[model samples]
Target: MAGVGLALRDGGDGGAPLFAAFAGAGAGLALAFSPTLTRAPATVRPEDAADASGLLATVTQLGRLIGVAAFGTLFLNRLESLGASGAYTSAEALLAGMDALALTAVAGAVSGLVRRRR
Candidate 1:
């Protein structure tokens, strides 16, 4: 009974909904960037098997935050260009887009590192 209580409070089934959302996002990103995030199922941590959905959820959420900060900064940077316009420009937008792509690549690298040893 004590164990059950611990499980419920410590991110057991109670956290299912949050994890589900994470997995949905993760699946989308994983599929979109399979070339980077792809790995053997066996490589995933044993704990991940219990909630493949949740682990993905957590990662996806954090990734989104990291991505937003990186890409947003790239887009909003004040710069002088376009004939001394000294204002927001398409160059920043383009850089932001590429930063997001690079972020995805880094996510894949993280997944590889987190992957369990066989």
Candidate 2:
């Protein structure tokens, strides 16, 4: 749903669609985060639970950092290059960034599903 909303964005519509997309993504993450954190420790022995939890937290934070860095780089590069051309606006660059992030999210989800199946 979030992916669909992001992909559909054309940089001309009102804020409602963007808001909905963000809301949907937030809600989905909120729903998935708790169970994932809970389950991570459960897969380990009692004494190892803390280590598992710590590892999970570390990985999660690292993933977020990498994602933010990638997104920022992509967005800023697009903004600078396109803005220089005078043919595209910041909004268009923003939309491009959002679309790239959405595609990345979709790919991650699919890969996770495949890993789980295997």
Candidate 3:
């Protein structure tokens, strides 16, 4: 999912971007069920389960928004900084920004794993 999203471009030969979109869609579908599935076994009462699932969905959406805003700000700052370099095209700046975004995702995944281990 992250891989496919990171691979997207403004335009190019072949249907690579289309393929990436499908991949992203697949990822989204997988993620969509996660909160409900996680709550299925974790919560005891049905009412509590419903509440927890709702809360989970809300938090997940909030997290998504925050991540987008933070990463977008970072990307724009990076692109602005690279603007002065004549050799760097907009496409190149976008790709660089995406690379940085991907790194942050990797960092988040790593931290999640570390936290789980404790």
Q: Please report the candidate that would top lDDT against the real structure.
A: 2
| lDDT of every predicted structure (CA atoms) | 0.53, 0.77, 0.64
**Model 1, stretches more than 4 Å misplaced?**
1-48, 78-88, 96-118
For 62-116, candidate 2 gives per-residue lDDT tens digits of 9999988998898899989998999877777777777887788789779979999
Regions of model 3 farther than 4 Å from truth: 1-41, 111-118
Clashing pairs in 1: 22-57
lDDT agreement of model 3 with the native: 0.64
Which 10-residue window of candidate 3 scores lowest in summed lDDT? 5-14
In model 2, the runs with Cα more than 4 Å from the true position are 1-13
Residue-level lDDT of model 3, residues 2-97, one tens digit each, is: 444344444243266658756775775576557545745485676687687677778879988997887778667766776777555455555665
lDDT of 1 at 64: 87
lDDT of 1: 0.53
Pairs that collide in candidate 2 are none
Each candidate's TM vs. the true structure?
Answer: 0.39, 0.82, 0.60
TM-score of 1: 0.39
Taking all chains together, the TM-score of candidate 2 against the true structure is: 0.82
